[model samples]
Target: MNRALLLHGRQYKPFKGFMEKTKQVWLVVFLFAFSGRVAAQADTMARQSAFRVFLDNDFINLRGHGSDQAYTNGIRLDYFNVLSGRRGLFSWMPRAGENSVNTTGVSAMQVMYSPEDLKKRQPDSSDFPYSGGLTASYSLHSSNPAKKFSLRSEITGGVMGPPALGEEMQRMVHRIMGFIEPKGWDYQLKTDLLINVDFTAEKMLHEFGRGAELVGGANASLGSMNNAASVYAIFRAGHINPYFNGFLAQTNAYRGSKKLFYNIIVSPRAELQIYNALVDGGLFRRWSGRDVSKANRPTLTASELNLGIDYGFALSW
Candidate 1:
């Protein structure tokens, strides 16, 4: 009996050692990945294109998913006199053409500009267009807690052209508060909330352009960090353009008036650290594409895929 007990104890010692080493290895790997992501973010912020130009291209083929094969390209340009510090930001989110399967088109570019950099360059508050810009953002995380949690949010907004122009739009919009146009860009006040805890992880809530729309969804991240991905289900409801159709003199006779659609998106996002720069690639499938005029039209099964990439730059005082 004594000899048998000794053999069992000896065998258990190796198992315990193996478990401890395994835990240490995983911890090291997690720290390495986290540090790498932070370093990449910093690098992105440090390196600014002399002209500050950005282009995002999406070559999406949506056949088995829901729609036809489609491709999208977006371009953004910023001209800055790094010497004199004069800068201008311009962008376009135009689509190649109308897709028959999904009838999807890219939204207009969100435009914004500031004479001085809010992050670093502080100008006289009295200066025209001193601060602000257009808004665009994204976030990502996991549903499982045993892994790690990564969440991010980005927003860009500011007045374009001279302060006088912003004043002009304000004046005109108020003056013709009763007149309506077919369609036009509307100011947006979007807020996003994300929560990941317990088994019920990942929730997204968003409000777009005031009462124009309300959206909510849940997501699940699958796979490991090296091969991470997520799937989400989203629901959007509200007027297509409340300001344009109701206040901006736009005709409300078509299906474009008040519409609601249920969209399911199988989003695949990947992160990579290259040369200390963190690059994120996203692909989205927006299903149930249809223009609702009377609310009785059958919802289309077509899908629209969007591909996007964003790079964050780290700045330090």
Candidate 2:
């Protein structure tokens, strides 16, 4: 009887510890979300429905489950409801294209498939999704360009559909030897939650005659996902002028001076994961992907750097 009680105690101890740690993780997320809201204006963006549609290509996600650097392209439609006036804060619910990563993350460079392959595609590997997130942003656009600013806070959560971005897992051994296309990308469940806030205020420090505005802004973001907090800095420049679009504009950039215009956007960015949690073992596994079993997994984080260029037109009514 004593031995039986001893064994039960051992099991209960670890389970209790895990639950406590999980609570701490959620607590931190809640605090970050609250602080982000406090740092913004009392009012949100203008509730007016200024909707826009966009097609985007992300030459980023350097740490995605797989390699689709060249094939990332998708269309997104989002609506902006002003919570306050332009001065007030606004909220946003955005779906970044269904299975956006899978759709665009296709390996245009290496992998090839026939049209029939499309029909034969398995749902698990399909680029279709049901996902979206909510965001609150505030924009200050003053005549004194220096006073122009854009502040945004976002909490985004969704699933990656399937592990389509990565290679197969059961073939882990063969993949290690580069034998069978080296799969094992998204071996875990594909849901992820990210909480981020970015503040951007620009100054037209330099401009050429009917040319471009050399602008600078403080573009900072902090969020958490995959049991880690993610940070990124954004750099913007060139001929296209940027007007902080708050949550309304989605991804359309334009020259502020034109009624209908297109602009060239060059943005260089970097991201890093810090203070990681080892709730699950294994480096390639996202939070959902990690095996609760401790035998083969270790806590880890990832970092990334990217240079992306965007060209698109916008209309202001």
Candidate 3:
């Protein structure tokens, strides 16, 4: 009976130790899970509180050297926020990676086009047509830092021609800058409805330390305003941020380390333009007693294939 009791005590001691170790393992797991959840919540809150504004104008183009022709002035205003709930138009979109960030944004934009000589009341027919567009767009952007990829989708609606107020905006700016008044307004593209959908995808090709990186991307647009597809590569150097964070790295709200940002970028692109309403005029015919082509205005014969290079520098805090 003594031997049996001793054996039972030994067995009980081993079982008790095993049980205690199992409990400790579960406790560690629970702590880790709790900490992960807290971190995720913090990230979500930071994204929700972030906002940004953007303005673009060809008048500020560094390569133009004060000349305004072809694709001229443009202005854009954007507001963005992280999507808190997956119950919207963009909810069905697939994320790029396991831990991808999603953002929704709205924007208002105005674009202007003109010939080389703005002083001529009746510009050369072969020159770029006088046209303008004003649009409002809703967009969805998704990015994955680990995979170094991003996706963007957007839908836009608005109007073209005089209703866009391009001529008036240009005149106001020119008057403010003490430049010569533009001469051709009546010959601008006629009023027309504008609607388009666009999608873009970008991936980091390679990274050369923290100072430089190469990114490649493609964009597609379809609608009454424009139908085109293009591919481009971007080379950025200087104090650059992660490009996967967002367009122009504007959506890096969770980054708390950087107080200032600056970069020099060079992008080369090739586009196959199926159609461009701004250059080709409206798709539908107008019988308003105006002498015009099938598109209801004077249009230029634009190249179906276009190649261009862009250089710019950005500084922001």
Predicted structure with the largest lDDT when compared to the true one: 3
Question: In candidate 3, where is summed lDDT lowest over 10 consecutive residues?
Answer: 1-10
lDDT of 3 by residue, 111-182 (tens): 888776889998767676788999999888888888899988899999998999989988887787666677
By TM-score, the better pick of 1 and 3 is: 3
User: What is the lDDT, from 0 to 100, of the residue 137 in candidate 1?
Assistant: 26
* Clash statistics: count for each candidate: 21, 22, 0
- Residue 180 displacement (Å), model 1: 25
Better of 1 and 2 by lDDT: 2
On TM-score, the leading prediction is 3
RMSD of 3: 23.0
Ranking by lDDT: 3, 2, 1
lDDT string for model 2 (22-59, tens) is 21110001111221100111112332344443332221
